[model samples]
Every structure is written in C-alpha cells, then in structure tokens.
Target: MSRTDPQFKLRVPAALRLQIEQAAQATRRSMNAEMVVRLEASFAKEQPLQEKAHDQ
Candidate 1:
C-alpha cells in the first residue's frame, strides 16, 4: 500500500478471504501483507521451475 507501488483491487472467494484473515491474525500481519508474502513466495517457487525449463 505504498504510493509508489501500483495498487490493485482484488476480489477473492469467501473461503479464501477467511483463510487469509486467519493467517494474518496468526502472523500479526495485515491481510494485505499476508497476501503479498504469499504471492512473493509462490512467485519465488516458480523461478526454480522456470530455470530448469530454460536449462532443458
């Protein structure tokens, strides 16, 4: 939620939203922060697959 970063509005299913809220509460992070961390982790996980694909 920085002024410099592009902002987006997301619409998620109710179940997913509840999961995120619960995770945020457990981790003491805002819902937005929780989502961002999860997104970054997912993208980071993809990089290894992408590197292997390029090596093939």
Candidate 2:
C-alpha cells in the first residue's frame, strides 16, 4: 500500500527546537520522523486508561 505523509507546521521555542534536533540525532532518525513519533507518544500518554484497556 502507498502511504501519504502528513505534514505539520510548528513554531517551537529556540531551545526546544535545539533539543528536538539533538534527540533526532541521538536516535538516528530524521527530524520529521522523530517529531511525529514524539507527538504520537505524547498524545497516547494523555489517553484515558479505561479507553486503552477497552481497546485490548
């Protein structure tokens, strides 16, 4: 299957931008992929435990 990539335009503080770049390098992932993964994980954490439990 062909996948279409999603793009986001974010305005981050300079310090946070540097941190993201560093994290991307440390994990050997491109900046875009690193940001997407981080955002997904962050949203996943905010999900209700009950909702997640029901999914399983």
Candidate 3:
C-alpha cells in the first residue's frame, strides 16, 4: 500500500492475527499485504458463485 491508498483500522481475534502473521512470514509479505491477498482471493472465489446465481 502507498501513502495515497486509503487506510482503515481493523480488529481481528488474536488467533486470526497469529494465522495471518504466519502466512505473511511464509509468503514473505507484510501483514497488510497478506490480508489484502486473502481478501481479494475471497472475492475471486465468490465471483463464480455469484455468476451462477445470476444465471439462474
């Protein structure tokens, strides 16, 4: 994220935070990037289901 990118404060359970930390370390990314990647992937997963629903 850049200085121009909007920032939002978020709170997650400690367990979840730890999971993110581990994933970030393994992927060699910051916590912020890890969360962004996972969030984006979630949206990608939903896209196909959304299209199926729209078709029906």
lDDT of each: 0.95, 0.84, 0.96
Q: Please, what are the lDDT tens digits per residue for candidate 3 over residues 1-56? A: 78789998999999999999999999999999999999999999999999999999
10, model 2: CA deviation in Å? Answer: 1.7
Please report the candidate that would top lDDT against the real structure: 3
- Superposed by TM-score, candidate 2 places the C-alpha of residue 39 at a distance from the truth, in angstroms, of 0.7
Model 1 gets an lDDT of 0.95
- Give the C-alpha miss distance for residue 29 in model 3, angstroms: 0.0
Winner by TM-score between candidate 2 and candidate 1: 1
TM-score of each candidate structure, all chains considered together:
0.84, 0.69, 0.85
TM-score of predicted model 3? 0.85
lDDT at 48, model 1: 92
In candidate 2, what are the lDDT values of residues 1-56, reduced to their tens digit? Answer: 11476655889999998999999999998878788889889878878885878899
Worst 10 residues of 1 by lDDT: 1-10
Candidate rank order under lDDT: 3, 1, 2
Residue pairs clashing, model 2: none
Per-residue lDDT of candidate 1, residues 1-56 (tens digit): 67689887999999999999999999999998999999999999999999999999
